[model samples]
Target: MWEKTMPINEVRELRGKTNIFLGVGAIEKIFDIAKEIKEKGIDKVAIVTGKSSYVKCGAWHYIEKALKENHIEFVLYNKVTPNPLSTQVDGATKMARELGAKAVIGIGGGSPIDTAKSVAIMTLYPEYTTADLYEYNFIPTKSLPVIAINTTHGTGTEADRFAVVSVLEDGKEYKPAIAYDFSYPMYSIDDPKLMVSLPKSQTAYTSIDAINHVVEACTTAVTTPYAVMLAKETVRLMAKYLPNALENGEDLEARYYLTYASTIAGICFDNGMLHLTHALEHPLSAIKPDLAHGLGLAMLLPAVVRNIYSARPEVLADVLSPIVPELKGTKEEAEKAANGVREWLEKVGVKETLTDLGFKEEHIEKLVELVFTTPSLDLLLGCSPIPPTKELVEKVYRESL
Candidate 1:
């Protein structure tokens, strides 16, 4: 383990019959949820999803299939999009109200889970929009119990209180959402067996997204030693195992560690928040949609770190340097630490320049404008030692190209 400060992780500390149920494999993982549902004594179940991945991949269908087998009554609401629209969540909440769905199950990756968390909030509160909680909304109303079955483990949606959704508000894209301590899933299933068949591209994307989680958390200005320690372990696991999982889909150990790493990063960031890479990536995702969160981080981090190093170089380098031994020497040699991260990314196999990704040279100015104006920029911009100036951001993009 890389030594650092211990974590001051936030606590909700629910008591009683193990509020969370965890399963690593076995088809029974989905089957056992009905008992939990029965124990929660819920009426109808509203499943919020629609990416075609769950039904086809056996994750989404497992609950329904098991529900029928066990003679449990339920409903399915599958109208979710990639980023998830607030209107769609409202529609799902309406359906749940009509059906009287007493509980919710989120099956699939981050999007469906976000849909489920947001729907729970809307159904319970009935007053707030899915757009309201983008920045720690901390909605007070308690939500219907959620059982999140993560067929994939990139986002740590099960472990988090945040539900992220994007919508076009007033003809312009306004990414909005909320989070609260009460919003976390009552149960988060982490089963690596279900991950056996995950495709290479998705494995890469999700695992890289996990890497972004750890790296961004550790770099923040207000990070605690507790945050740094957990983030350090997470990055070490992601750096070693994410690539293995991406390269060899059936690598159970790799998948397990990466998945665990993903969850750990969410816990780490919840206490300390995140830094500029996430701040930069959000605008790109809103505008491009083509670039998902992880790939966007992959493209921007090398440049982001290189720039930040000139300012807060030592702390940042120490945080990451343990994982990348290539740069380890004396503190005086820490100047080369940023290079280690770039080399490690290449070794993990991030290819293509930003230009190769179809990021238009013409769009850089527009993206810069979006970055400056967005609320997320405010959330994350100050985390950087040298807060990004318009000219500096543009220069980073140019260097990236």
Candidate 2:
């Protein structure tokens, strides 16, 4: 493991540029923010979101009312789905361009927010085809402004510069890739009221996903003290408030804390990055587009933690201490951490294994091949505490199964 203090210059290089508005009724202020955007010479805007969640939850109604009140001319691109495809991004960008939208407002969880980020930048480079956009070399110098509304407590995409989108390549296979800088949202809103109608299953999964972010980022080889602090605070909040939020979706205080933790964890992982678990899980979701990102994280996190334990016990102990009480008193740090995470997942009602989620034993070899071939493989290697081997990754997959 690369254990050394982060240089002051590196710490200073961290970038979290979103102007955040967090409170009980922050959604009500969207009208004023829209008015401000209009005042800034943006005559038209685009609202990117999932097909039904926002509408069913009434969050979309609120956003529409606010935009109408501000006379903010905008187009609606509500075709986004879970594990958002680059096709959806390109489609949204095409709509925004045709409507001449000067900005984009993402109104849901990470999928929509990330889609909006990609759309915002694509608007600036309309000459590039969808295939051209995925080339990474075609980086945009600027993007239309973006406003992120947190309708879910997971995916903290609202507060970070990075976006994850699935791109189809080499015929039919879809790969997950990272985009940054130009994709960051210009503003973020965290209104607890907006999350009151989120389903319990989603609530549990998203909370676990945030916890996964904190654990993976804080224990990685690239973490800094600042990153560790953010991760620690996130874990503390997850341990104390996640169950409350899961048990009673109407609990505004619990919802607020979880939302806060998700945002902080976003900033942490955006700087510290994530490891093998994310790399492994990304392909699962790309292959099974209907699977929620959080569900995959919950199923795989404990196994990934265990795989790295022998090489980084002390770090794992510190990482798991807040959430796993047994780890606070054990010399067996890695074992305790892995067991604790598995226990918590079951306690929170996320007991599904890879098989339960439709990963058959026959699919193991192909999954392993995809992981090794992934474009994000370098990131996975850099983030793992112990450098991963192909055989080790295959074992993790079988264990997850």
Evaluate model 1: give its TM-score. 0.84
Candidate 1 Cα outliers beyond 4 Å, as residue runs? 1-23, 26-30, 69-72, 132-140, 310-315, 328-335
Estimate the TM-score for candidate 2.
Answer: 0.92
RMSD of each: 5.1, 6.0
Q: Each model's number of backbone clashes?
A: 6, 0
Which 10 consecutive residues of model 2 have the lowest summed lDDT? Answer: 6-15
Runs of candidate 2 with Cα error greater than 4 angstroms are 1-16, 135-137, 328-332
Instruction: Estimate, for each residue in 127-175, the C-alpha lDDT of model 2 and write its tens digit.
Output: 8855455546575678899999878887878988777787765654545
Computed on alpha carbons, the lDDT of every model, listed in order, comes to 0.68, 0.79
